[model samples]
Target: MRKLTAGLFHSIDGVVEAPNLFQFDSFDDDLGALLTGVLGRVDTVLMGRVGYEQWAGYWPNAQVDDDFASFINGVPKHVASDTLTAPLAWQNAQLIEGELLAFVKKLKQAEGGEISAMGGISLVRQLLFAGLLDELTLMTHPVIAGTGRHLFEPGDPTTRLTLVDSQQTAKGNVVSTYARRD
Candidate 1:
């Protein structure tokens, strides 16, 4: 089965929105190297509608996401959205219309290496609830947003996870990788 990993940057308080401004220092060369290595092994990266929209506005020309734009542009990305149609701003992108759980389960069986979900709180919430995620890579920042979009919603239930690895960045970010426990 293909692995679905959730890679996110968040606050220690669990707020996972608009983290770059105050958390830029949290990303360092070591962390960059580690992320690069992880991305290299993944066959595909997926994103939600809003996240895709946000990336569409920026990545095609600039690809601020990484020097991996060439790789990202070429890799298959399955997007979950009710409003988006085909012919995304980025190449090799597709739209998942309905029944996310089955669609993702099928995707996991059909083809590809590790598939990753990188953005959007609503979509992540759904996937998490469906128990589709296999691995999680979280970078916990120090600052808290307190009001922006959060990765985990209020009353979100807890799920068991096995801590596979962890590290502390120079800027106080706690980088941890967890695997969903059966």
Candidate 2:
């Protein structure tokens, strides 16, 4: 079964929105290696409509002779959007049909390496709450944003997660990996 993993860039105070507003230190080789390793494990990219639109508009034009650009542009992108349709403007992008939960469940059962979801907090919350996420990885920066949209919504049920691994990047970002406790 393919594992559904949520990889998010979060601020110190748990803000997952508008990552560009957060203070990002220099991306040294350590951070590069870390991101490369994370991207290497996933065969598919999952995202919501808004994130898909943003990424589709940007990544198609940002391609370079690099692993990230190549992987992002070349890999299959499954967008969970009720409004979007294909042929999607971005290469290899497809709109997910039927019920979202059912689609994700079927995707997990399919033969694949791993599925990764990034950004689009609403979709991430839905996947996490539906118990479809097998792993959650947060690359948390050191500075506090004080106010913004948080990763966990208010009134969410308590879900225990077991920490699988953690490492600090040279830029002081903490990369923490967690597995959902069944």
Winning model by lDDT: 2
TM-score of each candidate structure, all chains considered together: 0.89, 0.94
The true-versus-predicted C-alpha distance at residue 97 of model 1, in Å, is 3.6
Error of model 2, residue 142, in angstroms: 0.8
Off by over 4 Å in 2: none
| Candidate 1 lDDT by residue in tens digits, 1-182 | 88888878877678777676557566787777778887787787778888888876766677545656666667788888888877666777888767778988988897778888865677766776788988778888777656566776668788788999999877677889988787
The digit string of per-residue lDDT tens for model 2 on 1-182 reads 88898888888899988777885664457767988887889899898999988878887788488677788999998898889877788889888888989999988999988899864789988988788988888888888888888989779999999999999988888889998897
Query: For candidate 1, which ten residues in a row score worst on lDDT?
Result: 63-72
In order, the Cα lDDT scores of the candidates are 0.77, 0.85
